[model samples]
Target chain A: MPASKIDLSPHNARAYLEPGPIVLISSRHGDETNIMTLGWHVVLEFSPSLVGCMISGGNHSFRLVRQSRECVINLPTVDMIDTVVRIGNSSGRSVDKFADNALTAEPALRVEAPLIGECYANFECRLFDDAMVDRYNFFIFEIVKAHRARRPKHPQTIHYTGDGDFMVAGKIVSRRGLFRPGMLGNGRS
Target chain B: MPASKIDLSPHNARAYLEPGPIVLISSRHGDETNIMTLGWHVVLEFSPSLVGCMISGGNHSFRLVRQSRECVINLPTVDMIDTVVRIGNSSGRSVDKFADNALTAEPALRVEAPLIGECYANFECRLFDDAMVDRYNFFIFEIVKAHRARRPKHPQTIHYTGDGDFMVAGKIVSRRGLFRPGMLGNGRS
Candidate 1:
């Protein structure tokens, strides 16, 4: 091993594992609705938009998602980092995250979970797989609806690098004529 | 909706869905082994370290992985951007990716798949889930072994923003005293 890249302790690798952007997820089961910050989530498929996230069984939203099988993934920008951390630190089991965060709930197109109006983009997803929920607390969701800030074109997203630190999206560089044909067009910058 | 943000088409959301870092995954079945580029992979858990990834049935590695059930997730630095895209654009069924790209394969500690020597960190993963393989072509992996470069401290990692553009990780920012005490400290910058 070189002096530059250190062998990360596998146990703590999640800190450097590119813990995708911290997003506020809204889950509703009947009358009980909850919002929580999620840092362990990622895109799984391009079409039908399958997404996977690890939601601990102890989380209040986990129960709501289990009963309802629906939730909205709200992508927050760098500006919302503080709010993201606050929501993450607290649990929805006791506190009403929506009221605590002073966030507005907007009706989504496809799911019962309302979208966080403050977020840069919102994805309404239907739980696609519950097979690994007990063993790993993982949920596979198929995004049934999607919405984003088209005006900003590209909002500065926050990526959690553990240690309360973040790396903001900056400097967009694209490779021309690299993508295989027949993949989506908008994927081309 | 605020003029600052817009709704994104659900079909093309992957472009902005926080497409983590593209990794070179090497898989072997019998004598046929292959390396493929993966942008649709993510961390599904922290403890047992479960990872979820989309491996299209069309790829040669998918078949190998189906039979072998093991592969290595190699994290490449920003310097390997060109090679990352090249490996992604091509397939392993027809050409030898290792010879074509001059990537060196090293022995792994816990898995049969060899590590990519040129990458910064390597995760030897064992296939953990096959339930969704036929339907969604998705696989769940357990990172049984982990290896990383000790030098370079923190190498600049790349995040694909769709198209040919890539985001080079820059300037670390930390949120002081945010993580749980027992979570792990070395993740601190």
Candidate 2:
């Protein structure tokens, strides 16, 4: 194809997953709490607990996250896509998403940011760079306290791709059939 | 759903995305050719153009890009995902991914890096932040040149959500249906 023809509209668009985990970001300035959808979060390092997320300046939660310097990354279920996309397309400046979606907010442990009760995983985070926020809309965070849902479900994580698209995680697929210790031939055994 | 019952295994499992956008990080090393898989990338800025991606600490491709502070971000299509994941999983240390993928490496006009012909969108990038990568495994690059696919298909972009699973971006829900202008009697509209 010529170098001038690729289109990025949402027609026949599919979500591309990077093979990582997903987390939602919840932030609050005062009594008002908001949740922004995300699948761009990644674990950059292990020691000292560092997490990275790229929030665009075009996003409303980006502003709140910048102001508070704190937010919660929550992992919602696939069933939450309708809500996720709705939040992504609409702005929190006008609509109260929690009130519109009937979602509840709970207090976080180490941060003032609120956590969405409907989410399965939550990460309370503190901001990393102040300059990058306005310049690149990308924020690196240090994870403070992590929380998991009270109940376990089978493959219940949700992955959000760009646009208004998402995917529900499938069953575990390992190198070996059912993952036997001797099955892996990498010489680790 | 008990917090104690939650297993962090899935969140920690390392997986590769087979079908996703192929980003070519083209760099030059001592008059030698260098190009590698760069799927951990995203648009970070709108005006003045910026992008971000992650490069392993020991990649030869990144070493050259760091030296010149210049590179190119090329976006491939679904047809090229197989090659994308292959290079991403394997290292450039053992094999030349461009030759393995049968891609043409041509020097960019604005940057010293080469551009991959297999990709649909190509962006010439200039280093934006070295601290983000040195500290957080995050590297930000600004786009100086961009090209579209030779053939434009439907508007579909791939996103890496996690695991080998991918979610195809579905239709664009109507913004008018969700919230019409002046529909909410409040002046906030």
Q: Best-fitting candidate, measured by DockQ?
A: 1
Model 1 residue runs over 4 Å out of place are A1-19, A183-189, B1-19, B180-189
What lDDT does each candidate get?
A: 0.69, 0.55
TM-score of model number 2: 0.66
Chain A (alone) TM-scores for all candidate structures: 0.84, 0.75
Q: State the RMSD for candidate 2.
A: 13.2
Docking class of 2: incorrect
| lDDT digits (tens) for residues B61-169 of candidate 1 | 8888889999988778878888888888887868999999998877776778878888877777888888878877888888776666655544577776554556776
lDDT of 2 by residue, A73-179 (tens): 76666667567656755678888888888777777767898778776556677886565665556686776666554344222554433222233444432222222
DockQ of each: 0.25, 0.12
What does the lDDT read for residue B27 in candidate 2? 78
lDDT for model 2, on a 0 to 1 scale? 0.55
Model 1 clash tally, residue pairs: 28
TM-score of candidate 2 chain B vs. the reference: 0.71
